[model samples]
Target: MTQALPPLLDDDQAAFISGGVSISAAACRSGGLPSMARATGCRIAADRRSITILLSATASAGLIDDVRRNGAIAVVFSLPADHRTLQFKGGDARVVPLEPGDEALAERYVDAFAGGLEPLGYPTQVIRCVLACRPDDLTAISFTPSAAFLQTPGPDAGNALRSGA
Candidate 1:
């Protein structure tokens, strides 16, 4: 059986996701071709069973197509301040239509992302362009994580959080 994520994401995890940390999503083709793209923001489902990522279709055209063609995906969220990271692997990935206010979500994400980068000495304009996107072309990709692993720096990285196959 698949072990579900905790009933609620912990404070650190929640902050990392909502704080506009760097987001990267990847999907593979049945033939093993793979693609990836940067994501603007992430929303965890109410039930904590899934994650919805804000991706610009213009930027992730190949990754979006791969997810539609193959339902498996891997998303990694990392904080720019620290290398703290987490990866969620799922099998039910999909390219769903963006809901009404998702545009604002992306906007806030870009703002936060730029803020995060600024402290690290990156130019503001460069950071904004790194995640620029239009709502009309955005899509929400949701996935239920079938597995979770520790990806923090040090010896425990890659350790499984639960006992499962």
Candidate 2:
């Protein structure tokens, strides 16, 4: 009997996918093209099977007096190795003005005092926080493997079998 193969991500080809660089690695595996878009530096409103990236754009002309506006960017991908396709949708992003002493506020959010004691002196605020809200900002990645490739077994398996177990 043929032994089951390990997950595709465990293969050498998967190294490129986790490197957080060029999408070409995944593309090659899927036998599909790769693409990328600039991240607006906005916080992630939500992350599920699909991720939402929020970006604030400047308003012009008679457009609503609101300076902050939301937009949606969609990404679709097919995983050839997995023989599956996925879709993602994102939108509902809003921009807000930068607040002063933002770094201090951020520290407060992350500060977790372990023991009970008098309030400790505040640390110097070194970061600033910008508020941006987005209900949805869609970006997607997918893959679809070829049937022939899926059915074919790697030579390594045959070698291991010949060597016993």
Candidate 3:
């Protein structure tokens, strides 16, 4: 019999995902082309099994279309200073309405992301521009990670991730 995989994200991984990091998403378009977009914020479900990403409906239109057509998605979160990265893959992504407080969540995310890059000499305005989104145009994409991978640049990069590790 095969060993069962970890059912949810461990505490450490959850913390990492909650920290100030740059979020981006990718979806496979029709005929295998790829659509990519920069995400403005992220939220993990209470169960730690699902993640919801906030994105600009206009900025991420192509990616949203791809996810609608095919539910495959891959999201990457990376810290600008250290380049620490993690990738989560799912085959059942879906676009959904934003929750009541999600607008504020997106605001905080933009602030934290800009602050994270400030020390590295990125102009605050530029950083904010990269993640700007109007509240009315914001959308959420939710997915349960079927697989996780360590995407940091190192010998261990690409290794499968396990909870509690």
TM-score of each predicted structure versus truth: 0.87, 0.20, 0.91
- Whole-model lDDT values for every prediction: 0.79, 0.23, 0.87
Error of 3 at 109 (Å): 0.4
Lowest summed lDDT across 10 adjacent residues in model 2 is found at 20-29
User: In angstroms, how far off is 54's CA in candidate 1?
Assistant: 0.7
For residues 18-76, what per-residue lDDT tens digits would candidate 2 score against the true structure? 22211111111123333233222212112111222212222111111221232322222
Tell me how far the alpha carbon of residue 141 in candidate 1 is from the true structure, in angstroms, after superposition: 0.6
- Candidate 3 local accuracy as lDDT? 0.87
Q: Cα RMSDs of all predictions?
A: 2.4, 16.9, 2.9
Q: In model 3, where do residues sit more than 4 Å from their true spots? A: 1-6, 163-165
TM-score of candidate 2 versus the correct structure, residues matched by position: 0.20
By descending lDDT, how would the candidates be arranged? 3, 1, 2
Tell me which residue pairs clash in candidate 3: none
Q: TM-score of predicted model 3?
A: 0.91
lDDT accuracy of residue 40 in candidate 1: 87
Candidate 1 lDDT by residue in tens digits, 1-165: 445435334556656676768889989888777899999888876666668999888889999888888798888888778888787788889987777778998998898888888989979798798788876778789887776666778898887664223
Please name the candidate that would achieve the greatest TM-score relative to the true structure: 3
Using TM-score as the yardstick, the better of models 1 and 2 is 1
Model 1 regions more than 4 Å off: 1-11, 163-165
